[model samples]
Target: MPTKKELLTNPIQHIDIKQHNVVPLVDAMANMAYSSRDLNRAAKIYEMMLLDKDCGVILCLAGSLISAGLKQIFVDLIRNNMVDAIVSTGANIVDQDFFEALGFKHWIASEEYKYGAHDADLRDLAIDRIYDTFIDEDELRICDDTTKIIADSLEPRAYSSREFIHAMGAYLVKNGKTPANGGADSIVLAAYEKNVPIFCPAFSDCSAGFGLVAHQHHRSAAGKPMVAIDSAKDFYELTKIKLENPVTGLLMVGGGVPKNFAQDIVVAAEVLLGDDADVAMHKYAIQITVADSRDGALSGSTLKEASSWGKVDLAWEQMVYAEATMALPLITGYAFHKEAHAARTGKNFATMLEPVTA
Candidate 1:
């Protein structure tokens, strides 16, 4: 058998806690056998990509990030020109609106609240709040009025999430529907200003619900469909945009629809590239999730699976097993700081999209 000295003599090929002062949370991550080093490495790789001009487009898949209070992080990315496109959940959009609309708060359940729960058997760690104060029957009516105003103002074609939200916000402002003090102006305003595209496959989760409710009322009153737009064509248009670009980076905040939808695109690109494609089309990838991977669920699957399918760059797949709220800020902050630093130092940065053609 090989001696311990022989094994010790081998060059270290991975990051070890002894070599660096990792964040305490990251240490906890390592202890759980998660890839903390991989996340750091991926951050470094992303920094390198941001420096590359040809990198062109950056895609972020955000799920429930707004509820996690990480909307600012995404907004920061857009402000710093780190992301050009986004695929996200409608619930998050709604949560942002809820937070902005009423100065709503996210709260942890007190012991009393937990003890008095009807579903005592369930492990209830979720944050809770009473929306009893902000329930406005007129809110749905306003949403309906806003939707009609937008349909009359803009072309009848389907719009990206960013576009949709902006139109609604503008209508609200024009009609003097003041959101509660300190409320967010919706993600639509941010998207509009930055010219970034935000797509929400499931739109009924938040304010969209109010919009739908309004639409139903309008249809009954006017004998016509109010929100009669089709999403199939929108999907087709998004697909065409991705194909024309032919390269992307995926930053998945959570699992579920957003994760699968973004990954599926990478799979399609891989198939198009054929067997000998050396340079990955989906170049960089990162995921922060709480799901357990033991069941072979999509949420828990390691980046290695994605690499095998050409959905991520083997060298840059970073998986961090932490809350998106905790990890995304750090990663996004680092990316933004690096970009600002590069701009100050006059250092040229570009994204690498060259396929290693054998």
Candidate 2:
């Protein structure tokens, strides 16, 4: 096997949507058929979300997108005020984005090494692979340790994922791990700076879980209280967004916990407000995924189906059957180049959830 240094030489470079104007390209797709037309319409819907001042657009992430070089797109979205709130998997926020904020990088795996052909060797080399992307196992361990450090520094109490994520962003800022400090621009930092709340309902399922496990083990042995994640509080805080800003839109990439968590907030608000359907469903929504709805899995389920459950409105919803990497830049870039988000202002959803002081 080759040396680790040789394998990790080429770091994945994130694509910048702002530099590449795709409005004409995406507009041209409207004349095309199949998924192209569907993607064009989805792009338009995303633009509508940005143009609508009352709409709070929640971007849901449920895949290894950051590691695949989509980090800049998300950071740009947050910076441009295109996205109001974020619902994501812990891996995206912690293992990928936050990990990079600390100066580590995801390398591009060589062709011969991908597709499970060199898995045993990669394991031996302490290199983890996410499809075609490669991450150093040693660096990821440091990421886990960093989470523990953050948790240890906090008061012993249950925190919503949003709150903990905010702490992570604060940690990066305190340590100078932000763009202005000559570090990578990260999703966590952008969200924190913009006061946009980010929720990871299954927060403990990623690197954070390993760190919390180590943290709890040490604190328990010392007979001390430990910090913990309150999944219910995560749900409640997100539901509060729907109640406060009833005109919402969803731009979902792939689907899993983030997609479901974002959609359920509507019903959750209804339950809190009253039984007479006081909460409004997501006004506009778009999901890009390759998963098949015939599998009866939540990831591939149609938004129209979600309306039946009172989650998404069918009139403005569209399901684009395409992969995220191919569609996200074009759709997001279309809106960016059109300057739809330029007219939008950041929605400080994080402050909305903070405890009131007398």
Candidate 3:
């Protein structure tokens, strides 16, 4: 066996290349010898997951990906059928709605601006500029009204997040609301069109909160029992989804509740499949994050920890520590473009790069 000192001093050899552009990055990934072998290896894992017929579900868990300006990636993934289900932060969904509502944009603040004593106030510093461009009153009122509608329509029985979003979308379409602005319109339309399911275990934390409050008001008006969300139902739905899908893949963008929620699905899959599953439960995972693993934050927890629980395949999982805004667009674009190229050329693009299994 190799000594720990040797392993530490000389880690496994990886392809090495230094370039920031997306084309070069994709080319490097395509040619195994062109760049960091670790990255190349990671790309292969992703490709395998995309191609695997058994891999019916792809779960993306992240924080603030919408705020990072990666809604296009989400839209693209849904368009391409890259993801069958999504488990994401409510904040991300809310931010996406905000973006669609007012066509808001995000700008990079200087380090000085971020480090200032009044940094928290900086959010509002742009408010005047925002109001100059768009009004919030209309947006808030629309959100409130939509929440009320969804609350009134929801059945008393437990429903998955995707179901609720779809119901809301149908309602909007019936009411002649274009599914363009930040409403269940986009999500509902995409999922319904794709036949995909989305489960947000922490749905209440997001705009669902507003819907829940509206439900409370509706109940008050009807003099009925106020229905509170049952956490057990969410947990059960997650476990059930994992069991039904033997080959699972996770694409975690950031961390927080979404991160853990995605990870837990893999664990549930392993427990449910046991030894009979051929593809290996949760065989592929990719994460783009900025949190520090050394800090022991849940978002920063490494794939290695998940492997220990058989939640992830140690040989196939990939971790890319970076911003979602920077990574998601590039990867999504590359994957979809590759798929399109394959479709036109009559080639199996999904299997172009094979996983480097141990």
Candidate 4:
């Protein structure tokens, strides 16, 4: 049997979209058929989103993207002003991104291990697997503890996921867990510096949940107040963005909560602002996923279906049935190489919502 150390020898290195200019390749795909053409259209729409100064681009993430080596791609999007806001699964923001910010890593499982050939041995070794990626369960406990420490340091009140993630960024800076301090750059750090708000609607579903659970249990035992996640507040704050910025676009990877949450914001705006609100649906939308709509799954639901709900506009929407790891780099890299972001400035939407949140 291979040792845990030997099994986890190779860490998954994130792909930097800056390194490879996929402009020509993606442009070539414009003439192709099937998902390739859809991807090309999606890339062009994203560029158009960037070029339109009035449009606020929201990047919705789901699945295990960060663990699958797509962390830097999101960081770059925030840095380059390509993404105005982020909606993601809790695992992407906590277990994967913030875990790395704490100086840990996700490893690529060997071919043998990927087939569940050694899962029993892995559990005994304190290794957790996410598909073909491996994480040190011991190190993850430290991440959970760190979140608890951050929670312990905060005022006992309900906080939106955005607010808590902002504090996580503050913790990173205060503890010198940032690139300037010789640590790795991360999604939270980059989003924080860029004034981008990140919302995980299901906030307590990841490592942070364990931390919060511990914090709450300890505080309850001591007869003191403890912090809690306000999911409704998360919904309200994000809807506030839609009402404040009438023109918006969505670039979603995978589906589920992040996708549905982002899309529902349009309807939310209508409900909050009333019939006189005059809010418009998202101007452009693109989704990358391998899920089939035939299953009646939310992740597989097409943008056209969203239009029926008045959530997304159908004029400039395309669905590329490809896995995120394959489609995101090509779409985002093409936009980067074409210099789409150069013509625009980041909305810093988080700053705009500060007074309301405060």
Runs off by more than 4 Å, candidate 1 = 1-35, 56-63, 98-163, 169-186, 267-280, 340-358
- Clashes (backbone N, CA, C under 3 Å), per candidate, total 8, 0, 6, 0
Ten contiguous residues with the weakest lDDT in model 1 = 349-358
* Model 3 segments more than 4 A misplaced: 1-23, 29-40, 98-138, 179-185, 226-228, 269-279, 340-358
Sort the predicted structures by TM-score, highest score first: 2, 4, 3, 1
Single out the weakest 10-residue window by summed lDDT for candidate 3: 10-19
Q: In model 1, what is the error at residue 52, expressed in angstroms?
A: 2.4
lDDT for 4 (candidate 4)? 84
Residue-by-residue lDDT tens digits, candidate 2, 1-358 = 8989999999999999989989888999999999999999999999999999999999999989999999999999999999999999999999999999999999999888778999999999999999889999999999999999999998898899899999998999999997787999999999989999999999999999999999999999999999999999999999988888999999999999999999999989988878987788899999999989998999999999999999999888899999898999999999999999987898889988964111
Per-residue CA lDDT of model 4 for 156-209, tens digit only, reads: 889999999999998999899999889999999999899999999999999999
Model 4, C-alpha of 305: deviation from truth (Å): 0.4
lDDT of 3 at 284: 82
Q: For model 4, how many clashes? A: 0
Off by over 4 Å in 2: 355-358
lDDT (10s digit) by residue, model 3, range 252-288? 7777776677667665555556756543547788777
Query: What does candidate 2 score on TM?
Result: 0.98
Error of 4 at 242 (Å): 0.7
| Alpha-carbon RMSD to native, per candidate | 13.7, 1.6, 12.9, 1.4
Clashes of 3: 6
Question: How many Å off is the CA of 326 in candidate 3?
Answer: 1.0
